[model samples]
Target: MDCLFEILCWNVRGLNDPAKRDAVRVFVASLRVSIICLQETRLNVIDDFLVMQCLGPSFDGYVYLPAIETRGGILLAWNKSLVNIERVSFDSHTVTGEVVPRDNNRWWLTTVYGPQTHEEKIDFLWELAERRSLCPGLWCLLGDFNMILYAEEKNNDRLDRFIMSRFRQFVLEHEVKDLYLQGRRFTWSNEREVPTLSRIDRAMVSVDWDLMHPDAILQALSSSVSDHAPIHHSLSAAFRPKRRFKFESFWLNLEGFDEALREAWVCDPGIVDPFRRLDALFRNAAEYFQAWGERKLGNIKLKIAMANTLILRFDVAQESRRLSQAEAWLRKVLKLVVLGLASLQRTIAR
Candidate 1:
């Protein structure tokens, strides 16, 4: 059986807005996430209907902590088919649970939303440590810790040594390790005139949990509607088939492409079997197109830049004196070529 499971944690800021909720739905669906941990939902309460709308019908069960006034909240939702919830515990700042997979392998998951004030932050750390002690099994802790692990995790700000020391101590005493991140260095940004960035949101697993899922990886996704970027955790050995290359529409715009395709397709070395002949034709076409693309369209951006430079030079020349018939023709041709290339690129992207 495949032992691969994917969990996503995000400080969505607020899911109260319909647009933000839709964005969350789209993002989670795109990733094919199995479990979700959301922080700072800013909703006093979330019902089954709202969960269905936000996470789609796949997630049938959820445990959440309601926000206080306008502050912190935590929510944990899972697909019933993929995970079996053994128990759930929640406070103003956290939601902790024990989940067993179909294979009967069990693990503890805790999603936290640390307090902003220093004293409350200290209390939050100790509470986390206490939870770690209670759940003596493979454990995964994730969400907005509201603090940085290291000085480098924060940008354009002075690191608070006392806070960092305590946070470091908590991790050391608990024997938790970060599931190294990919994509961006920072997870949260203060959307200001001159922004401050920090890696406040993360996934940390117990030593045993690390051994259980050795191939686990964490990816930092782009922040679309919130100040914090979402983090996704999954196993590296997850099954995915190799993607087949498709012919791009832009390739048809290049010179000699038709001739190259025709030559590759018609080159028959007296092969008799229909299946074998078809395979050979396709192989030849792919090879021909790859070689042609490398030689002719090696770098589309560089070619576009060169064309732009030529156009600028001609414009400058026209300012000095009337252009020659050939120069005028060259300008018009360059404009058309630039437009064509840009349009082709857009079409290929889509």
Candidate 2:
């Protein structure tokens, strides 16, 4: 049996606006949030502790912990109902604590919004990973990751890949699983013409933690007041199987390309001889179709069989021309072989 749980994380940008702060109060009051984290407070004279105290009556005995704020500020406001609020990293920043009495407690919640500079950011990620390692089970890490996993993750012309590489390596070394790249698109938006968006804010956990709370999910909420959207999620005592993202369809949707590929295929030169060339073509096409079926519809073997049936039974050329699922079709082929397949289709070369 799995136990259901709920959690929230956000980079409020700054804890300034009275309405925004009040909204925070209402949001906290509304839910049974086990863990709550915030970043970029942008505080001047107000103390971090006092700001945390603002969640006073709603949290019912909570604690305010600060992280090494670069310019603005970072805070971790936890619910007493959620866990035994104990301040771990306080005096500077990077504050974390243990959630109490384990019936099936998978991870200890730790929130951080690291610095922008490479050196400072690296230090923050390394330290956070180190702290997680100490626990050695399930550790839920949240706040502005300040980094992205893929090229699609960022919207800027300038993405520091070198620094991002280090950050990604740290994630791999730490064995943390990113939750944002699952189904959602962009989490934070610069709100431009195309809207420069990136998943700077995210949540992640260990494999063991995934095993405990299977239903854990994260989504960026609308940032009506702040620049960055608020991230909301819930967890449960269920084990969700690792679902691969449908990244193929993204590649297949190209302009005036499928017809060219088919022409190229017919012109792809049937590997010598007469019957052998046809056999090879059908076999290759069958395999590609099968692989595509497996990815989109599960059952690789069955999918392959179906592809074989389609190629062997149906009018392959006509079907291929009318392939509304061109992306899915090419993806399966691309997955199987890498030779001369680049002409299949692509996403405008990044």
Q: Pick the candidate with the highest lDDT.
A: 1
Candidate 2 least-lDDT 10 residues: 339-348
Candidate 1 worst ten-residue window by lDDT:
235-244
TM per prediction: 0.68, 0.59
Q: Candidate 1: misplaced stretches above 4 Å? A: 236-350
What is candidate 2's lDDT per residue for 1-350, written digit by digit as tens? 22445666777766666767777776666666656677776654445455554454544444444333436466665555545554355423355666662353434777776677778776776687667666666577777777777787876757878777887887788887888544557778776777888878788887787776666667666675666777777776246676543334542454534653463245247367878877776656555544553444354345555555554433465566654477557655644533222322233133
Model 1 over residues 1-350: C-alpha lDDT tens digits?
22668888999998888988898898888887778999998888999998987899999989889998878778789999888676788765888899788877788989988889899888988888888788899899999999988989999667777888999998888889987898889999999988999999998999988887877889898887889998888854555686555777767778887887788685487999999999988888877777777687666677788899999999999999999999999999999989988876777679
* lDDT scores of the candidates, listed in order: 0.85, 0.62
What candidate 2 gets wrong by more than 4 Å, as runs, is 1-4, 44-56, 65-70, 90-93, 101-106, 181-183, 192-194, 237-350
- Report the Cα RMSD per candidate: 19.0, 19.9
